[model samples]
Target chain A: MPTKTVAGTTVEVNDEGFFTDPSQWTEEMAPELAEAEGIDTLTDPHWTVIRFMRQEFEEKGTGPTVRALGKTSGVTVKELYQLFPKGPAKIAARVAGIPKPRGCI
Target chain B: MTHRIVILGAGTGGTLAANRLRREYSTDEATITVVDQDDVHVYQPGLLFVPFALARPDDIVRPRQDQLHDHIEYIQSPIEAVEPDADRVHLTDGTVLDFDVLVVATGAALLPEETEGLTGPGWGEKVHTFYTLEGATALRDSLAAFDGGRLVINVVDMPIKCPVAPLEFAFLADWFFTDRKMRDSVDITYVTPLDAAFTKPVAAKRLGGMLAERGIDLVTEFNTGEVDGEGGRLVSYDEREVPFDVAVVIPLHGGQPYVGRSPGLGDALDFVPTDPHTLQSQSRPNVFALGDATNVPASKAGSVTHFEGDVLVENVSRFIAGEELDASYDGHANCFIETGFGKAMLIDFNYDTEPLPGHFPSKVGMPLLKESRANHLGKLMFQWFYWHALLPGRDIPGIGPDMPTTGKRSPESESP
Candidate 1:
């Protein structure tokens, strides 16, 4: 395990840069994390998915899968891909300060 | 003095060509020599089944020498360089072999190192690929330990062997998890460099729709620049990143190293440029290439190579007779896409045709571009056909180098 300093704060991360512990994540740290992951600006639509993923992770203990988000988040698959091209659930979970969601196909 | 014929690879393409050429020329007329680095002949299409344990790695491989004709001499040595001008090939052992006709069938190799961070930390631990034996075997373990999470199958670029394999993996993974009653726990995504799920627009739509129907997310137009294996993320130059618990990748592919070692023999990517129709190398008239070794626009599939072998052998016969080469090959490529649930979809197409929905070979034949139990069995039966009929160069009836358009439905007609 390695620790990466982002936004003047250090957090435990795995070799793939995924957060080792979700407890240390902060709402303000997402933009910097997103920037490092390739999203330049967090638009309203981007935040909508990010916030939804974070809320879902808090409530359910796991980020929503792409199918669940596409159906419930009011974001179509095409729109979600446009919003987060790396993949909706994977990137949104990262920006939401959650561990990379398990069971991503 | 015997006429020497040298084929540079022992994969499906080279093995079929060696057998076909031997049948065409008598033992006294021509002595065929096949050179390769090793004796293990992998059933590449079978590699897709390994991660799911549908097929074992050991079952998919055999000795390369066992596949060739007895008359064809097998040289177990690495090719250091190829000198087409002198009709000679230099092996790593410093043995120079001469040939009257040379066939470059030394198919492509996966180059994961070409992409930055792919083979970095957590490579074999987190990021895995099924394109190789070790990669596939490792992924089986990774998949077993995977309780649930995102499993991404990423195709680094197109022109990969059996272009539909990644999609098949996604489909099969769906079945595997569902069988374990854990399909709900896994998230499957197919990420590719193409804008659509597949290359051809019509086929892409159908395939893309299949992904949607199966609950598999489709991420297209993704040109991966790096794989943060340690972080389990794929970073693109465009600044998009795909993260996963386990990544099954079909890494970037390029022609064999020896192809580049030879001057004026291959294109920039080491793929020998061949006339799309004649399958004869542009570098030399007597030189020919097929399969993944050629810089042709056709799909780099075993079926494509099988069709090319038919026309190539004829052209080789015509060349020796000083006659005009036959231009019969029309990029015929057929593929069976396994769609899980004991069903598969077959597609028959060529250079000018996209895969159309209809019965293939005949009007009442097995359904094409549509899944059926028969198609699944056909796919399973192909392994038997590959070793018995295909590699032996025996022609199966109704199948040829030209794509038959008789029973196929045109997109416009089908819609209207």
Candidate 2:
């Protein structure tokens, strides 16, 4: 088990899986989720989409539309869809370590 | 008695040396013999573009024995080991070939197994490399069928055959998807352990900028630790992860197996340590090395081999004639980077000089240190030059083995 800080979030990862150290639903948790997913290398674009997803989760407590996510991240809907096959709602939410939104199965 | 010259590994360097030496020395004066395990000599540079459908396999491969001249004896056999003290070579069949002069050109090999978990369940399914003929062909099918997802081009380590190849793959991917109308569907990423897109900082900055402009994600300083294929992830040592739908990995490379068999022949990486300037093996004066086998401070590209071949041919001839070997190889290297969208960049430099801005082969010729349509044409035209002029021992009209430093601009002294 390794406890580390990722993108300003304190995360704990043991033999089971990764979780928030403070257990707060925030944008900074994206790096930790990225780390858990084997995505240590993050460009500004990667962080942009990640941070946007977190903000959307915080504001509405739900994942944003793929178009809105792409607009915020300077990517096309297709491009965003390419990065996140299940859509920005699923990937961004997962990467931000936020719980899956309601009505978005 | 004729000068019995024994050449090992009848690939690029071996075949070229044998043919060049044959032209230089008559049959009565010197007898040339080339030894290798297989006769299938691959045009390695073409392998890079194969995955993108830019080149066909047949276009890049040819019979190894057919490339050499008629007088030269091409022995198709695996080398068991080399007895440096006895000035002899032991073949797998137990035949010992004694020679007055020996040339070891047993080039490098791809070792995908060297990287932990690289050859796991994900291999051939989602993970592939274009470095080998089969790997490139496999990737072609994978790329064609991939509707949309993360396509990562990762270079596991450095000292690869062609340093610019991975970048080329990224560039070509952009073009490949664009042609298929799926450019928007695929998210391309270029990952490397280096701090930049290239080894040289200037070229790195330039190429990195190009990667950015092309919407390709550049992930530097990510040393691949383990590949979790089932999970579609690449985990680094620091527990950083880069997930991919399809991962194109250029695995760690090493010198030929024969190098390890020959005691004190190679370093841990299986590369022979030689005087960079002289191209003479550090172990023995009678033995010489060239191409990817030597640990020369240059890109392991064909141009470097062509340049080194000139100096090596001269040095070998000098050594045979009882003359002092001139240690004058300048570590010259030149490469034409194929940046997709019908464009390419040309860079020429030596040990002391970095790739600077200006014209190449003289101020009146091709663009240097800059990408241009003309340079792209030059790159495409090189395949013909490689076969007709370069390989068959026929010299190019103006270009010499040593890099021409005159017309190239200095890094510090910027030209307007």
Candidate 3:
């Protein structure tokens, strides 16, 4: 596992830079992770999605998919793309310190 | 009192479980009943080949009850709802069947209506799907009439049954057009909501490379918001557009509507909240689920259902006998991926392991993660096996529920 410094804190991450140990993630790490993924700032809407993702991951053992994030994360699917840009489910999970939402291959 | 087992769906999981359970218990000791909405049990795997005209639609379907053991009771009635608390099932025909154990195997249903304009102007004309018998047949006609232009294969969302089927359809389409001597006039593009061609990393990389090599364009992370079939464009949630001359779209899938009707039965998607390892429903002690009906994070493929049958049958029996349930199911799943022409690739994996490059069953058995004519032959031969060995619950020689690792090579081993 590779370790990276985000927000002055060293955290373990996978090959794709998603947190290997989600417990190492702090609320302060969200802004830096967001910036790493090309987002300029951590706005209130971004935090709402990030917090929802974290809570969902804690409860379900996995982050919600883009559809689930849009439906239940209090963010519209259009707004999700506006907030996260390219991949909402993936980028939001990264900032929230959760594993990538997987589909069976 | 005789132990009553009511297995719903009568599809792959339900039929196999019924047959296996029947063999375990005599009719005097237990009564096995299987229910489904209809008698036609279409060989779902064959649906993948239907659009390509490789398999006839009529040849792939059979009477559902014919597959079950004679001792097992078969009911043809649409399920109304499952009263889990009362251990009763209400059918649309007004029959309420009581059971000591209930197995929910009612598989996923395709919902094209969920997306705006998907079922609009050119639904059966320009935009088509191969996920259903009707869709596959309609797509066959559409593809036959299609001579040229941009042909896009779009997957609407994830967790769809046979996740690799859409990819198979694309590969076969390349072969189909080439066979017709019209390969040049056609441009093939594969669109998906995922970040890659597939979910697993190794398989994705391998499959993605194959797509590029075949000159099939891959558009990833595209969350389709609407299908403008009349205008011939797919509008994403982000407003990115992928224009198509004809679109083969795999629509969003959810569990049967009856699952949602039953309170405390299913998740947001209507897939039963199941214990992934145990194959038991989280809602009630006597309730269990398998196959596409459960939100178990496994591929919704027939092989997964076949592999799961062994564990699910055992656990169902255990629950009835007042014994400990077996939690041995390790999310084992395998699929034969058709890669056009006369070759196909095989992949075998389980929970905690991604599809790797190696042989399956044993080191010398068959090539894994690489296209081979032998795997293609295996794919062709599986239809016969599906009817004879698989649905009857007979044990396949040398293959068990657990994923075999003997022939597999790990990434770490290769790196060192």
Best by DockQ: 3
Query: How many Å off is the CA of B70 in candidate 2?
Result: 1.5
The candidates' DockQ values read 0.02, 0.01, 0.48
Error of 2 at B341 (Å): 1.2
Candidate 2 lDDT tens digits, B29-120: 88888999988988888897888788998899989988888899988889998877788899997888998888889888898886778999
Model 2 RMSD in angstroms: 15.0
> Residue B371 error for model 2, in Å?
1.8
Q: Per-residue lDDT for A1-105 in model 1, tens only?
A: 899887788998877667778888887898898887788988898888988887877875677666457656877655787888756677787777787765211
> What TM-score would every model get versus the actual structure?
0.80, 0.79, 0.94
Q: Which residue pairs of candidate 2 clash? A: A38-B241, A38-B242, A39-B241, A39-B242, A40-B240, A40-B241
Give candidate 3 misplaced runs (Cα > 4 Å).
A1-17, A21-47, A102-105, B413-416
Best candidate according to lDDT: 3
State the TM-score for model 2: 0.79
| Candidate 3 positional error at B130, Å | 0.5
